[model samples]
Target: MSNTLRISLIAVASAAVLAACGGSDDRNDGYTPPPAQPPVLNVTKVDGRYHHNKSQQDSGFRAMSDMPPSASPAAEIALPALDAQAQTKAQGDSLGGPILIALPQTVAQAQTAEQLASLLHWRQDAQGQQVAALRVQAADALGIRLGLLVQALPDAALLRFYPDSKTAQGYETTGAEINAVLRLNAQAGEQGQAARTWWSPDLGGDAITLEIVLPASAAAEALQLALPSISRRFVDTDSDAALQAPPAQRAGLSKERIPSAGSCNLDMSCYSNGSAERDAVARMSFVRDGKGYFCTGTLLNDAIQSDIPYFITAHHCISSQTVAGSLQTDWFFRTASCGSPYLDARRTTRTRGARLLYTSNVGQGFDATLLALNDAAPPGTYLAGWDARLNNSIQKVLSLHHPNGALGKISGGETQNYANCDGRHCRAATDGRGRYYEVRWGDGTTEGGSSGSALFTQSGHVIGTLHGGTASCSAPDEPDFYGRLDLAFESGLKNFLAAAQRPF
Candidate 1:
C-alpha cells in the first residue's frame, strides 16, 4: 500500500473534448489554456503486490501434549524501558530517528519446549470447542526468538502484528496481554486456509510487549510461533512484496525523499483550516516484500450515515483480495503543529484488516476501490462528505492526504481541463461519466503516500480521489488526475455512500 500506485506523467496524447454540454465547469472563458504540449514522460504503472511467505520448521523445538509443572518459578528478563515522555515531548522529538536494535537474547530450543509444556492449557476456542492454548507471560528472556517483541517506532502510536506461519492461521492470538487481541480466523486466497495479519491502537506508549498464543486442535510436535521481522518508526514489522520487484527508478530524485515525497511546506496546510473533516484523512502503511510502503485514503460518510467505517482508496493500492485483507490504516496521523518538522504524531487508532468491496480496472476509467474497515472508526473520527454530480462546474479544488506517510497536508489547484484519456488508454467521447479532472496545482504537490486522498471542491465537497499525475515541486507545471466521484458514486459506491437513511 505504500507509494506503489502507478503515477501517470503528462504524456504526448491527442487531446479530445470530453463534454459538449459544458457540464460542471465553473471556470471563466478566459481561463481556457493552450493545448498541452508533448510531456517529457508518460504514465507510470506499478502493480499492487502482496508478500506472504511460508516459514520453515525449526528442528530444535518439539511439541509435547503433557508435562509436569515446573517446581521452580519461571525466570524472567526485561528489555530496556523507553522514556515515552521524552520521545513525545514535542513535535521535534523523533524516537532517536528510527533505530532498529536486534536483541541479543535467544531462548534455547530445549528451554522453549519446556516453557510451552509448563504454561499451555486446553481451552475452548471462540466457538467453545476445546483446543490446546498457551499464554506466555512477558519477560525479556522468554520469547521464541531474540526479543520476540521489538520496540516499535518511539514515535509510533500503534502496533500491527502479522503472524508469519500459515499453520497458525486457524488459532493464533495476538495482543492478548495488551487486551487488543486479534485472532487470524479468516481463510484467504485459493487455498482458503491462508493466514492473516492484525493490528492494535498505540498502547499509549512507544514500545509494546506482544503476547503470542498458539492454538491447536490436537497436541502436536514441533509447533512454532513464527513472528515476522520488525521495522522502526512505523508498525510494518512484517515483510513487503514491493521490495522484491525491481527497485523503482526515481530519475534524479534523492533516495531519502524519493520513498516519501515532498517536505512540509506552508502551501500544504491551508485548505482545511484545521477542521474535523481533516480527521477523515489517514496515512496507510503496508508490508509487501519485507519492505514498508506508504499510501493515503479517506474514511467516508454514507448518505444513510450508518457509520459502518467505509474507506476509499485507489484500486492500485489495494487491488487484490490478499492486499485488501492485509491493509493497516492509521487514523489522525498528522503532526501536532502545522508544517512542523516530521515527528511521530501518528495515532494508535488503526486496523490491520479490511474487506474489499469493489474496484475498477486499472486500465479503465476509474482506478478506485471501496473497502469496509473490519473495525469501526474510533472516537473523534469524521466521515468525509462528497458530491457525485459529474462536471458540476468545479473551479478550484483542494487535496488532503499524507504524502510519503508524512503528517497530513493539503494541496490546491484550479481545474485546468477535462480529458478522456492519458497516454495509452482513452474512454469513449460520449462516456461523460468516465472523464477525469486535469488539475494544475497552485500551491503544494503529491507524492507516494498521497494516493487515494480526497480531492475537494471550493465548497469542501469531495469530487474525486487521487489517481496519479506528474505534479511535484520539481515539475510544478506537470498536471495530475483524480478518479471522478460522480463516476464512482454511480458505479459501485452509491449503495453505501448514497444511502438515504441517517444514523441519528
Candidate 2:
C-alpha cells in the first residue's frame, strides 16, 4: 500500500479503537480535554515570527587590555588524577544509563572570603575597577566546572572564566543573573546543596583562570564568595571528534575522542525527511551531583504557535529547577552532510540554561519536564508541534536523539501497545490506562544519552518523551518506552501548551 493509504488506515483504525474504548468523553482518565482544536502537523517548519524577544547582554564591557597585570601570580590549587578504571567502568555501564562525565572534588582551602583574598592576585583596571584573579589546575582534565555558594554578590560585580588571562575569549556573567537563577530554583522547592550553588559552565581545558571585576568603591571584603567544590570532567562529550577514537585507546587518552553510539545507530542526516523535527531537537548537557551528564530535549510549539523556547525532556534527566538552570543545549549537532563524519561547524550553536516550568515524577506516571530557555534559540530552529488528544493513536513513530552525546541520530519504530514501564521492566496496561507507549524499533536503537528525546508520530507531531527501556544495538527487537504526552498534557502542561494561560 502507498504511504498515504497506510496513514489513512491507521487513523481510521485509531478512531475505531477510541470509540470501542469508551469514545471521546471517557477516553481521558478523569482530566478535561484541551480547549483548542487538534494540532496541524503537516507543516515542515513553524515560522520564526513567534520567536520570543531575545534578551540583550550587558553592554559597555571592557576588554582584557583595560586591566593591568596582577601584582603577583595567583595562587594555584591542583586537583588529583582521574581514576582510569573508574572512568572505563562508568563508560561501559553508561549504555542504558545517564551520561556521566565529571567527578566531584572538594576545595580544601580558600573557601572563605578572607582566605580567597589572600590567595587572589589583586590589580586595578584603567577604569579603576578592583580586579582579582585565581587559577585552578586539573592535570589532563577535559573541562572544569566550579560550584559557588554565594552569600551576597553585588550588582556591580562581574565574573569571568578563561583559559588564558591575556586573551579576551571567555565566559562572562553578572551577579544578578546568577542570583536570579538561584532564586528561581529556591522558589521551585529546590533546597538541596546543588540548588544552593551556582554552577559555572565547563570551559574546555585542564586549567582555567577566574577573574572577578568589582567597582572601585566595592572593597574585596564586600564580596562574600565561597568555593566549596568543583567538578572535573574526564570525558569530552561536546567535542566534534569524540566518536573518532577506538575503545582500547579511550582510557586516559586526552587527545583521542570518547566513543560514540554503536555502529548500528543511524545518523539523522542520512534521511531526507524530518528536517523540521531534526531542527527542533537538541543535545542536553547538564551538571547534577557535581557530575556532567547528557540527555536530549525538543523545542515545543504551543497552541498559539509562539516561539517561547518552551522545551520538553525526561523528568529523570531534570526533575528539579536547579538542574534545569544548569542545562546547556547544543543545536544543529549533526553531521556536515549525509553519512558524513565531520560536524557542520557553522550551523552548530550552544545555548546556556533554562527555567523549569513543570515536571511530573516517574513514580507518579508520565516522566516529563517542561522548561523555558534563558536565551533565545538559534536561527533556523523549529518549535515542534505535539498531539495531546486522549483519542490520539500512534502507529509509526520516529525518535531523533544524540545517543552517547555524539552527533544526532534517528531511530524508526512502531507503537506496540500501552504499557506501565519503569526502566527495562514493562507490563501491559488496561486500555486507556497506561502512562507510556511501548515501542519496538526497526531501524536504529536508543542509547545512554538518548534519554528525554521526543517520540514523533507519522505526521511529525510529538506524542511522548523517551523513558528508560531495554532497547539497544545488541537487542534491536527489545522494546523501549516513552512517557505519554497526552498524560503530561492533562497534568499541568496545559497551562503553558494550551491557550488557557497568559502568553508564555
Give the candidate number with the greatest TM-score: 2
Candidate 1 residue runs with Cα over 4 Å from true position? 1-210, 213-274, 289-291, 339-346, 392-394, 420-434, 500-504
lDDT values of the candidates? 0.44, 0.69
What is the per-residue lDDT of model 1 for residues 17-120, given as tens digits with 9 covering 90 to 100? 21110111111111111233222211111111111112332111111112122222332322342244432452122111111111222233223344544444
RMSD of each: 17.1, 8.2
For model 1, state the Cα shift of residue 321 in Å. 3.6
Model 2 TM-score on a 0 to 1 scale: 0.81
Q: Find the 10 residues in a row with the least total lDDT in model 1.
A: 20-29
Over 233-340, each residue of candidate 2 has an lDDT whose tens digit, in order, gives: 887545444432233422322332434777778878877546668888898888877777888899988766666788998877876677788887877777666755
For candidate 2, the 10 contiguous residues with the lowest summed lDDT are 16-25
User: CA lDDT of 371 in candidate 1?
Assistant: 74
